[model samples]
Target: MMENIIRLNFTKGKKTILQGQLNWSNRSADSIVGISGISGSGKTSLLRVLAGLEPEVKHHFRFNNICYSDYQAADKNIGVVFQHAHLFPHINVIENLKLALKAAHHKAKRGQANQVTSHKFELEQVIDGLAISDLLDKSVEQLSGGQKQRVAIARALLCQPCLLFLDEALSAIDKENRLEILTWLKTVNREHQLPMFFISHDSFDLQALADEIISVNDGKLISIQPIELSALSMGGGLNRAILNVQFDHHIQEHHINAYRLIEADSLKPNNGVLIYAKGVKAQSAITRILVACDQVAISTEANFNSSMINHIECKIVSILPLDETNQSVEMSIKGSASQMLYAQLSNYSIQRLDLAIGSRVWALFKLSASIAI
Candidate 1:
């Protein structure tokens, strides 16, 4: 059976700053939808509206075929983490996590023994996954910026939210720790199947993490494009060009000795192609192929029922949450050929198939799904 997922269509903001209808849908169970724009472009405002942190003048938000009012959204099991780790200075890390858990429990129906045990297990899992079991005994004020941010994330996860929103959650940490935390967050999302919506000004982060990017201008959604890695032609030459391509995280510099150029039928940017390349190896030649993450699917077994042509047994290298609101999964898959491919699937699928790091899976994609760069 197909799930209705989430469908949102609405407008917000009275002034010209943010006054346009935004239509979005999450067909999958998990997604990471990214919103990017210049500062003051109302990126944060849109997130606040969706998360019920800010009021919307006009809005329609629906999830799983159920329409939710603003009040309902406000009470929804949604977790949010901001740029700063706003932990209670007077409290210790464990206390903060316990407080969040208690609050979540308090609002729910009377907990049974099994439910309580389940919650306790989940809490322990989150604490350990975030690697904050040791830090739990430390005071919030005594922790470093990175430690505090991890605790904040752990607190949010302890609530067992249906949706998680991160508004520059890693910005407070130093560059090295920020990246480490990001990797940990990916692992958490994969194992927990928690959907997330992340806001960032860093193009690299968005490109590396997001499945679908939402570009906003003046509070209006200007473009929604899949994040595809492209091999750009670097050197200039009349007959040949040097193409810098990245595959399996390794840069393979290709000199296009001879190739035919085929312009795309449609007038879309980044829609042209090199018909053929002679000098590059056959396996590495497809490095110029731009594969949309969403077009590729992952499964525990080979999809014999489907007609998708490109099927490769792959190892799950990493799984990152693309958009939590949609419950999307962005995974880095390494084929036996040492080629790296990105596949996007739902959190439901990940959970159903029991996919995890180092798990062997089949990456399925159609030949037509790949576009020449």
Candidate 2:
């Protein structure tokens, strides 16, 4: 038997703001695909087209060998969470979700749609998954930016759509809440076998959720590849890596986490890495963290007494100049056991350390308030 897949072919204005060809396939029914590009480079245009929101382009959406001819035809199977939560302002949170549930039920009865790996969602489960159980009676106007997003996501779940499209859907939320919600979404994808198309300016968000990422550049599809930090092509963006970490506890309610990098290798010091973040919960199921290249510092010897908690022994793999005329350089440093992390330094610093390929050194990292995700 063949594996399941979703294929999309779309193009707009022979010389316009958007052109795209995206294909999603995997052995597992659940997969998250990412759309990324620089602003004005057609990222949103491509995403809107792929989601069938751009009706001017002829319909070209397929799932499991079944095709939907138009946006209306596709609406039944697709649920979109926009950048802003578009809930009915007059209704309270529960009312909004109930409305979605009722609409989905009506659609189910009328269309009698194919099962097609669809997941049935309960109101309780939706609210619980999004942690909106407490906000049921609150009106939409009373909710904060993050709370509104959670409600919006919960409403989408109630529709029981086979596919989900997230358009920078969680941008308004704080880092801690965002991570919590992302963790919950990962569970949703795995347990319900639901697929998602994710779009965000933040590469960390893409790495956190996407399985495959499609890069759009200057109004055309540039490339498609498996999701990784290196696959980020937003042009002149920071280099980053995502790591699984264990959260020991919050220190002094200062919103700092006693975090330890999990599976980082024997090179990582036993002391591990701690992060200074706001709104972090001890119970936060945060499994992945984004470490920026700028956050890492190179040292000839591990500094145990420094305020920076994370220190790892790594060998310099490669050093390249950002610009021949500029003194700044970037280094690819590898852990003793696996994978490379980056550090940015000046020419003077490189000369002082006399670092080179295969030269063992330490990479010090500090997680700031906004980097927990």
Model 2 — which ten-residue stretch has the worst lDDT? 327-336
Task: List the candidates' TM-scores in order.
Answer: 0.55, 0.76
Best-matching candidate per lDDT: 2
Off by over 4 Å in 1: 1-14, 63-74, 110-121, 229-373
Q: lDDT of each model, Cα atoms only?
A: 0.56, 0.68
In each prediction, how many residue pairs overlap at the backbone (N, C-alpha, C within less than 3 A)? 11, 0
On residues 1-373, what C-alpha lDDT tens digit does candidate 1 reach at each position?
Answer: 2232222334434455554544456534455666677878777776666676655445555543434333444366677887788998888999999988886775465432112111222677777767789988898888988788888888877766766788877766776666556655654554555667788776545544554566677657565554432211101111111122322221137333322221122212222222222233233321234344566777788776876655656677767665662233333333122225666677778788888888888767653211222
Q: For residue 141, what is the lDDT in candidate 1?
A: 81
**Residue 36 deviation, candidate 1, in Å?**
1.1
* C-alpha root-mean-square deviation, each candidate: 16.6, 5.0
